[model samples]
Target: MPMTEEQLKGILRRFDTNGDGKISRRELRVGLRNLGLRFAGFRARRSLRHADANGDGVISEEEMNELAKYVSKWGISII
Candidate 1:
């Protein structure tokens, strides 16, 4: 099943190591790795590009929501 917004927020918070309310590239890489979705540098960049809707080089709450939808649509399980 797809994650709820609250569930997604909780997961994102775990990755927000600095508690900055955003996920930086480093954090994203670490988070993905923890989720068993390791990616090389180029692949990581591509993933970030796809999710960074504002082109701010980080994933904000809004972008994360969009990402959650994509993940759900693709049947990607975070658990």
Candidate 2:
């Protein structure tokens, strides 16, 4: 199943270490690692770019939803 808004928020909260309410590229790398994704450097950048719809170098709530959809489509287990 696709990730719910609460699930997304929970995941974001895990990596929003600064409590900024958003995930930056650095935070995304750490988050992915926490998810067992282990993305790095360009790979991490690409992943964030894909989710960052606004190209602001961060993942907002809406962009996080889009990421959840992509993850669901790819059968990625975020838990």
Candidate 3:
């Protein structure tokens, strides 16, 4: 089944270490690792840094929305 919005939100919540209602680069790395999607630490951090829009060290809801839009248009959900 495709991942639901609730599931995604839950995942984000679990990883938002700073409790800022947003996931930072560090959070994403830990979250992905928790999900068994391990990558070289530097590589993962770099990838997330590139994806982060505001450069605030974390990803905001706007970023996630954009990602969801992109995936809906051209990518397949792993779940």
Candidate 4:
């Protein structure tokens, strides 16, 4: 089943451990590992580099869509 944008955003939001309304590198790694992804640390680094357009080193709500797109490419089953 294809994931909707809202669902994707909600999942991304859950990864915000600090609840600061942003997804950090460490949080992203943990989230990916939770999804059973191999090399999650490397993936998180790449995702941060890709999704963090402003180079802030974190994925904010404004940058979430990019994160969603990147994660989707990994074919994650967010069911």
Worst 10 residues of 1 by lDDT: 70-79
Q: Candidate 3, TM-score vs. the true structure?
A: 0.61
Steric clash pairs (candidate 1): none
Candidate 3 lDDT tens digits, 1-79: 5776556555655777888878766776676677666473554476456556777776677677543433333233535
Ranking by TM-score: 4, 1, 2, 3
Q: What TM-score against the true fold does each predicted structure earn?
A: 0.69, 0.68, 0.61, 0.89
* Clash pairs (backbone) in predicted model 3: 24-58
lDDT of each: 0.69, 0.68, 0.60, 0.88
The candidate, 1 or 3, that scores higher on TM-score is: 1
**Candidate 2: residue pairs that collide:** none
Point out the worst 10-residue segment of candidate 3 by lDDT: 67-76
> On residues 1-79, what C-alpha lDDT tens digit does candidate 4 reach at each position?
7778779889778998889998999999999898788999999999999999999899998999898888888885454
Candidate 2, residue 39: the lDDT equals: 42
lDDT of 2 by residue, 1-79 (tens): 5556568657665787888878888987777677776444554577677878888888876687766655444455455
Error of 4 at 54 (Å): 0.8
Which whole-number lDDT from 0 to 100 does residue 67 have in model 4? 89
- Model 2: residues with Cα > 4 Å off, grouped in runs: 1-9, 40-43, 77-79
Q: List the candidate 1 regions with Cα displacement exceeding 4 Å.
A: 1-5, 40-43, 73-79
Off by over 4 Å in 4: 77-79
lDDT of 1 by residue, 1-79 (tens): 5556668657755877898988788887777677776453544566678888989998888788765554444345545
